[model samples]
Target: MEEMIKLNSDISVFLYDVLTKRQEKNAKYSLRAFARDLGISPGRVSELLHGRRLPGRDLILRIADALKLSPLETEGLFRLVHRQKLVQKENGGARQLLADEYAMVADLECYGLLMLMETEGFKSDIEWIARRLNVTALRVQSILERLERLNLIRSRYGVYERLQHRVTSTHDTPSDVLKESHANVMKHAMEALYNVDLNLRDITSITIPADPDKLSQAKEEIRLFRRKMAKIMGSGKTREVYNLNIQLVPITK
Candidate 1:
């Protein structure tokens, strides 16, 4: 079962490889092209694509819009990159501090909160959040309550602040193991957020019938399709885009 999970994660990582390559190629033709469109810089664009650096929420939204990635796809990309880093660490790549226990901020809501915090630090009033997010104060309050309950943010003296900077466990775990666990958690979270109707049991059962060669072919096909979708959407011609935030998962059951 673990092996099968790893195989699926490997397949997902393969898709991300193609997507990143496509993004890089698109950026190569005109570093200024995306930068101009995004109101950033060629240097920043390079850093974002290759440096494994996290961009601010606004920049992420701008890039996502420029790339024409769907909200779900944007989220998926964040997850993929995060898993990639973990994979690298497992293979003797650079290491970083693990995150302490805190809230799980998934999807757009996470991005929204991060943006507000970045721009305005922390605030306790829902009105402030609503004004910033351009939503009703009631909605902002609900979001804040949810975020606090999730432990993603903490409220003190009516102001909400980010609890931690990282998400993965700091304890010792093999890099590969961390990557695998991260991938599974990300996929699960994404599916839940986007309501992706992936009948996992059905998929596993169906795949079980295929021969090794056929399964390999199918996996490649899926990877190619994901790549194509990513390429087409990331064309930098869209007006609206979503900001995908970073996520990390520990390698523990």
Candidate 2:
């Protein structure tokens, strides 16, 4: 069983995967039950699973002991958790500022180009990137230069390499830039609705009454959901690049 199990870099994903498998064997098992087994509060477990909190060394050890992870898996979890701490630190400081600044003028195409570099069969050729993004070769070349200047991408031995695994524009992103970025993505979402096959795209919405005061919590949940999907979709052999746009807006006054 240990040999068959694979570990995910995201601790939340790893924990959830174990819970899910256990649930498969015992249908009545639930998060609360799992929390009891792990010797933590249900609320605490929920927060960890939802990405609202990061586990510390003690908590990691408790989880490892409860889950009976192999030594290799336990060490892998420690590494991943430490890496996550570093990322969180970066996101709260200078790296996040650089990312936000890049987003302000980078445009949608620039973001797309960055992700494209991660896909399988990716080539460093300007024309190839331009064709993939439906932009001019000049546009792709210019974006490459801008990214290189930012040290977000670098050319080594004739190969372009991506430096950042993620880029997000959060609270500090200029209002105008944030608006324009959303507008650009919304336009593409509209286009995909008509031109792209349903199998390739998921464009849907739900209309429900929601309290204004709780919006902050809702937005955080959406952010967590996006991160979870990013990890899941990015697993295995990534062959193509895709956009994930989730919008929750108020239609009623």
lDDT scores in order: 0.49, 0.75
The collision pairs in model 2 are: none
**Alpha-carbon TM-score of each model against the true structure:** 0.28, 0.62
Top of the candidates by lDDT: 2
Superposed model 2: Cα runs more than 4 Å off: 1-87, 90-94, 103-105
Candidate 1 lDDT, 23-137, residue by residue in tens: 6677453446646765677776554533335555576567557666677766655554566467546643322222321223333444455546744244567776677565788
- Per-prediction CA RMSD (Å): 18.1, 15.5
Each candidate: how many clashes?
A: 7, 0
Native-vs-model 2 lDDT?
0.75
Measured on C-alpha atoms, candidate 1 has an lDDT of 0.49
- Write model 2 residue lDDT over 108-220, tens digit each, in one string: 78888888888999999988888899999998888888876554566755899774455554455567777787898899999989999999888888889889999999999
At residue 109, candidate 2 shows an lDDT of 84
Q: Which residue pairs clash in candidate 1?
A: 66-236, 67-233, 67-234, 90-175, 103-151, 103-152, 124-158
| Clash count, candidate 2 | 0
Best by the TM-score measure: 2
- Candidate 1's TM-score: 0.28
